[model samples]
Target chain A: MLSCKEVTHLLSEAQDRKLSLTESMQLKLHLMVCKGCTNFSAQMDFLRRACRGYLTRDTPRDDD
Target chain B: MTSDSPSSPRVTPETLAALRTDMLRFATLQLRDPHLAEDMVQDTMLTALNKADQFAGRASVKTWVFTILRNNIIDAIKLRARTVSASAYTAEGESLDAAFDTLFKDNAHWSPATRPVAWGDPEDALQDQQFWTVFEACMAHLPTNTARVFMMREVLELSSREICEDLSISMSNCHVILHRARNALRTCLQGNWFTASGCATC
Candidate 1:
């Protein structure tokens, strides 16, 4: 199982692109019991959504 | 598709004027410079007016004008891109914070205080303008250079290689820097808005 730090690093990398199956599986497995890492990943998801909503309220978001 | 039909692109005087305002706001967010954003918006207006026929109603007037503005912003960044002392950029005086040291023991497990709580519906915060204000504040909290790299990657959606080339950093360094940035941002958001009892405050 990946440690919190290891999983968190992969979590950030996953934001840029899809993780490989092995990496995803490892992350998913780690996240299953690690509440802290889960919360951290969820926050990353929120950041992505919040940023995309930065400009385009209805559709396209230029906030990248 | 139906919003900006071929029948009408909605380029009225008032709409164009309003587009300018939106363009300026959008540019300001991307460029983070009011004066530069104004120039960008002005350039966007000029380009749109000149290429009025080219719009073709493929997108809404706002989208078309903002596209011009976005390109202008990118050009502005590229033009100003240059090698600098890493010391100068990272010189915002922020160092690896000591507080983070306590988050992990020798074994790299999360300390008790470091355990994050499950945040409630993030969508609720997304819909709140105050939440954005708080988020912007959190983003601004990062050291200036770190924030720039983060924006170029996440905001501009630049590839990792593009970031390394643009910032003259190594690939691994770019990855490390992004990890730091994401960590900082996620922590701040969790503290301020994501917790079950978080104030959701600005």
Candidate 2:
């Protein structure tokens, strides 16, 4: 199993590129057993979605 | 003055005003330079106005405007990269490297503070006005090129190779910067928003 540190790095990397099959398998297997990494993955996903909202969502004008 | 598509939302002066305000805020957050962000938003709106007749209503007017602003952001990022290589930008930051090393043990297990807290509904938690205030603060804390590379990859959903081309960095360099960016942003956010209330959030 990948260490939690390595798995967290992979979780962040997975957002930007396609991990190879071996790498993907290793990450998945680790996340299946690691709650911290799993929560981190969810957190990263949420950040991405929040950014998407930031770009396109309408804002109420009149404040700094 | 244009013809009758009842389903298509009209783009009015007030609408553009609101959009310009939004685009400025969004651009400022990503670029973190209020002047440059202002310039980009100005350019985007000018282009939108010049090309208004060409908006075929395929997407909402806001979406159309945002797409333009997004491209504007990409151009600005590329321009900055040409002005300075991102690798050199990272060269002086030994602390970032040390920061990464400190996260793991000799066996590469996570150290205590680096462990992920079970954050709340990220989607909803981030939407809270106070939480977004903190989020922007964390984003503002990133190193310059690291922030650029990170937002391009994670926020704008650009591919790593695209980031490489844009930032004039190699693939591995892009990965390294992104790794640092994520760690720094996560650590900052965890300190501000996650720890005090656990997953209860801001």
lDDT of 1 by residue, B35-143 (tens): 9888777777877887876777768887777777766776777666445446654454245334444567677778887776677787887677678777777777776
lDDT, candidate 2, B1-202, per-residue tens = 7775767776666567777767887798778889999888888888888888888777888888888888888888787776666546577345666776776778887667666778765666655777777777777777777777788887778988887877677887777788788777777777787774332111
lDDT of 2 at B100: 67
TM-score of chain B of 2: 0.85
Give all TM-scores, in the order shown.
Answer: 0.81, 0.86
RMSD of each: 4.9, 3.4
Best by DockQ: 2
For model 1, name the residue pairs that clash: none
Candidate 2 structure lDDT? 0.76
